[model samples]
Target: MKAFTTLRTTAAPLIDGGKLMANVDTDMIIPKQFLKTTERVGLSEGLFHELKTLADGSPNPDFVLNKPAYKSAGVLIAGDNFGCGSSREHAPWALLDQGITCVIAPSFADIFYNNCGNNGILALTLPQEACDVLAGQAGGGNSVFEIDLERQLVIGPDGAEHHFDYDEGRKEKLLKGLDNIGLSLQQDSAISSFEAQRKLATPWLEKA
Candidate 1:
């Protein structure tokens, strides 16, 4: 996982679901057909496949991600309940591969929200009105958004700051770039000591 301190980049808005445009599930983020592999490197090609691809397998001109302005967007401004449905880690992997390090939404599914933190993506929750404001700015295609993870603030294109709250532990992990494995490694000395003691107490079991 990469450390996430601050980011200043373009945002891609995915707010066209319908009504409240909520529940943009994991399957929608990366379709089932693209879930065949466990590797994360090439998942970007499959990110939002159904929505970004045309019936003829060409890139959909209408899709926000396919648009030239948002093609390299590093932030994603989404609708409510983003990352719902099945708890697939691949969703965040796909987003990371696509160069999106931050996602701003009104709300998010619990599992997906944690997955984002684990994978170094900032899954930010803000008021629905705030999300709408950011989305409007993102739609302009030229506006830049700044996310300060340390400050817990999202500075909009017009220089307005939207404050957000986040879990302290998760926030710290993201800032330190500590994934589960990295966290485990932090206890390496203690683990080694425990293993050495166990070997002494159960030499016969170790041989078996």
Candidate 2:
């Protein structure tokens, strides 16, 4: 898990009266045809690209994301275990490219959460009540929100705030944007020291 920290990003206003779309159905919001065109890059253009408008440049007014308030959103108050049902790192990549710095949810799939952190995106897990409050605020125009992971607080549109605590370890990885490989490399000095000590202590075991 990565370190968590307070982050502020523009939130995507969710419409349709708090409708919840979880698991694979979530990808329908994006689509696979666009997924194959690029690899973890250039995905932002494709993200919400189809759902946002028609080939004729007409807005799909019915789509939640296409709503006037959500068109330029950079964050999402998502359903539980979002990014579940698959291990596609592209999901977070697309979100990141679109300028979304974080996601607030009641829960998240383990791999997706990790992938988000690895790519410098924060994924905050809050209680359902807290999420509802955020979702409610999201329906407004350009609803900007902030999540302070260290303090476990969510700051809303009216400036009212709520708190939700998370594990200590997960917090650190996110703050630093360290993936597993990055974390391991951070231990390079310690690993080298250990190897030097082992060579002296077990000389007979070397190359034997």
Among all candidates shown, the one with the greatest lDDT:
1
lDDT of 2 by residue, 1-208 (tens): 3244666656774434455444423364355666675466688766666666787988777766656666566677776667775666777878777767777777887887777777777777777777777777876656678788767778887799877766666667666767778878899999999999999999988979
Give, for candidate 2, the lowest lDDT window spanning 10 residues: 20-29
Best by TM-score: 1
lDDT of every model, 2 decimals: 0.91, 0.70
Estimate, for each residue in 89-112, the C-alpha lDDT of model 1 and write its tens digit.
999999999999999999999999
Which segments of model 1 are wrong by more than 4 Å?
17-20
lDDT of candidate 2 at residue 74, scale 0 to 100: 64
Among all windows of ten consecutive residues in candidate 1, which has the lowest summed lDDT?
14-23
